[model samples]
Target: MDGILVGNRLIDAGEYELAIDAFTRAALDQGLSADVLAGMGSANLGLGRVHTAERLLRDALEKDETSPEIWNNLGVALLEKGEIAEAEQVLKRAYALDNGQSDSIRDNLRLVLAKTENSVYDEPQEQDYKLIRRGSSDYMIRTISD
Candidate 1:
């Protein structure tokens, strides 16, 4: 099987390390194509390496600007790293590229908008947090109120 397919499967299985290795092999074979970079980025994101994922996803975007999936993945990475404004913009692009057809992209966009709107709220003493994954690269953030 192709390394990109293998890497994506590994990511869906939540084997992030194996996915990274698969993506690395794919990158070596394909010379860092957008799909390979996106796969690597997704693996890193799954492993909680947000900064690395962001860089790889950005690279992927440079290689293929029209891919909504890449844009969505980058948005997720940015959101995880607390770059809310940029994430909102990235997700908006993804949503537009997809013509609002993808539920995952729509959900991510809504999550970013909610975060942007809620940023003005008074600080709570403490809040619970949740990381929700919709797909290999799609992430949704939720705050649990005490």
Candidate 2:
């Protein structure tokens, strides 16, 4: 798991080369853990190697089709590659796998759907904390009632 952890950090740092190396090392050492393959797919996706990500994630799914996160990330990669229908299908599967995993998948789905939306909402309904633009400050300032 060390390599996977390290690869995650590398991915966050935008170091796709290093992330890919770490994920490949982990997968090589572990020999086809679906988890490892998922990591590889994530790493490849970060590098904009969407085709590789798709293939690796597909292979991982073959071994274990129950991982919500894998399906979610695969959808993101597919979305990035402009494979809209495939991405939507994968994201639906991710949502079906687990509700907790649905947020990110739904966010991606929303982004894609936004492209087809007739119009954007004028603004979010007022709440306790509304984003504001003042002369010199921008903050999530909230109102307190006594």
Candidate 3:
């Protein structure tokens, strides 16, 4: 199989290091396409390398701005870096570009909005819930009221 396909499969299997190796090989052989860059970015993101993921995803977007997958991955990278506002904008753009067909994009946008909306409180007394990531997904859980 091609390196790109292998990279994607490795990503799906949560083998981020292997995925990055596969993506790098593909990039060296075929030059970096949007899909390859996206895969690399996502693998980096999975490994908690937010800055590297952001750069690669941005490069992917430059090569092909029309891909919702790239935009969504970029948004995720931004969110991981705590760039909530930019992440929201990019995720919204991805949702719009996909015509709201991507549930993952929609969920990401919702997560950003939830984080932003709940972060406005000045004290723990005023806060109701906190967003937490469990495994590969995020959840808003109610905090113990003081």
Which lDDT value does model 2 have at 27? 75
Task: Report clash pairs, candidate 1.
Answer: none
Off by over 4 Å in 2: 100-102, 115-146
Query: What's each prediction's TM-score?
Result: 0.88, 0.71, 0.81
Model 2 whole-model lDDT (C-alpha atoms): 0.64
Better of 2 and 3 by TM-score: 3
Which candidate number has the best lDDT?
1
- Model 3, residue 80: what's the lDDT? 64
lDDT of 3 at 47: 79
RMSD of each: 2.4, 10.9, 5.3
Give the range of the ten consecutive residues with the poorest summed lDDT in model 2.
131-140
Model 1 misplaced stretches (Cα beyond 4 Å) = 124-137, 140-146
lDDT of each: 0.83, 0.64, 0.74
Candidate order by decreasing TM-score: 1, 3, 2
Instruction: Identify the leading candidate in terms of TM-score.
Output: 1
Candidate 3 structure, TM-score to reference: 0.81
